[model samples]
Target: MKSIVAVQFIAAVFFATAAHAEDLEFVLVNDSSSDLVEFNVSPASSGNWEGDLLDSGYLAPNYEVGVLIADGLQTCVYDIRGVFDDGSSVEDYSLDLCDLGEYTFLD
Candidate 1:
């Protein structure tokens, strides 16, 4: 009976910790040239969860490409690489993100 009670208490604490986590969304764009391009965005380090936001062969024109990331209380560095469909490529760029809200790019 004592073992059963201790197990339940541990399980409750584990679930409670997992529930109060922060979720972040990462938004990337290719505001460089006027051509259709593909890119891959991933976390800089290992054991970091990069949530689902975009897919392969995704065309991110001179606009904003949004991606959603899992909830966590850690600084996440994203790697953005421009992958061209044809035999061409573009320069790599960096994005500054925060937990405020979405970013809007104006002309």
Candidate 2:
């Protein structure tokens, strides 16, 4: 039996993965059973969730995609939100993207 779960990882090994100082581009892995419908990334200090990074199609289970946080902000700390097809969502707070080369949403 499989259970839906959300896992967070932030290791020191990912510290130098970003291309540049301000670029927050990383690979998003959807390991959860449900399809990911929408993905949002916003500054940790802000109250509102930013635009959908997924844009159009949903990210199916076991699939992954590369996301570029083109906000152009110098800050690396941000909040992440992922909405699934089963009406369930996961939220991660104050993540330093510059140190995270990849993020996986587990099941």
Candidate 3:
């Protein structure tokens, strides 16, 4: 009976830890002009960014692209575009996640 109780307690702890992970996504766009441009998306907390090329042949005016944020950190998105490109744009949308408080186990 004691062994069964110990196994149940371990399973409960594992499940609780798995519930706190978060995932997020955002979109980027170009609003004006018909020129080829390149842009990058980055996580504000980690300072890690990825670059994508958006040229006249690949991207259209006012086009949107989606990006994914990794787990275990609070993230904010940013838009990095070339200056030669003409357009007004916005970035930095965040995902929603649960807040974990102190936990207690009882008999």
lDDT of 2 by residue, 1-107 (tens): 23323332222212334444455678788889999998888889889987776665687798777777655566789899999999999999999988999889986
What overall lDDT, based on C-alpha atoms, would model 1 receive against the true structure? 0.38
Model 2: weakest 10-residue lDDT segment is: 7-16
The segments of candidate 2 whose C-alpha lies over 4 angstroms from its true place after superposition are 1-21
Stretches off by above 4 angstroms in model 3 are 1-19, 45-49, 53-57, 77-79, 82-107
The global C-alpha lDDT for each of the candidates, from Candidate 1 onward, is: 0.38, 0.75, 0.33
Worst 10-residue stretch by lDDT in candidate 1?
A: 4-13
Off by over 4 Å in 1: 1-20, 34-37, 47-53, 71-73, 86-96, 99-107
> Estimated TM-score per prediction?
0.42, 0.78, 0.37
Number of the top lDDT candidate = 2
Candidate 2's displacement at residue 36, Å, is: 0.2
lDDT of 2 at 7: 35
Candidate 3 lDDT over 7-96, as tens digits, reads 111001111223444544434333445432544444444355444433232334444443343444433333333322444333433322
How displaced is residue 14 in candidate 2, in Å?
26
